[model samples]
Target: MNRRELREQIFMLLFRVEFNQKDDMPEQCTLFLEDGDTEISEKDAAYIRSKYEKIAEKLPEIDKLINETAIGWDTQRMGKVELTIIRLAVYEIRFDETVPTGVAINEAVELAKKFGQEGSSGFVNGILAKFA
Candidate 1:
């Protein structure tokens, strides 16, 4: 899988985090990889899983940055799609040195356009711009 595909997988896994209990994430991650219609190579699967784990480990700090930068909007109040996109973008922007800040922001906006609600791209772009 390409980087974009890996990012989408990571975002999907992160979205699952919002719904599942922490204890279930390992199983959920396994099932996600195993049950997919499209097969992912072991190398790509490992990359996705590792990146997801790292981002999840830093979620508290990520959310804190969102809370601090988002002004009046609380993290809980944000749409799940938008919040998930933000989390992914934030992870790339702050933690992953391999992804450029501009590329991260642009890819995040693209993901928002693809997966988020109406106006979600703009909303996500605005929030991520703070970090950029």
Candidate 2:
């Protein structure tokens, strides 16, 4: 899988964090990789799991940043899809130096377009622009 595909998988896994109990995430992540339609190689699967774990570790900090940057928007009140996209983008922007900030923001916008509501792209762009 390409980097974009990996990112989408990571995002999907991260999205589950909102709904699943923390204890179940490990099992859920494993199932997600094993039960997918497209077969991900072991190497790529490891990469996805590692990134997801890192992002999950930093979620409190990530949500804090989102709480601070998003004017008039509480992290808990934000749409789940938008929040997940923002969390992934924030991780890329702040923790993953390999990903350029612009690319991270652009990719978040794309993810928002795919999984978020109609205005989600613009909303995500607006929030992420604070970091830019």
TM-score of each: 0.98, 0.98
Top model number, lDDT: 2
Per-candidate Cα lDDT values, in order, are 0.92, 0.95
lDDT of 1 by residue, 1-132 (tens): 888888888898899988999999999999998897669899998998899999999999999999999988879999999999999999999999999999999999999999988899999999999998
For model 2, name the residue pairs that clash.
Answer: none
Q: On a 0 to 100 scale, what is the lDDT of residue 60 in model 1?
A: 96
Off by over 4 Å in 2: none
Cα-based RMSD of the predictions, in order? 0.7, 0.7
In candidate 1, position 3 carries an lDDT of: 83
Model 1 misses residue 69 by how many Å? 0.4
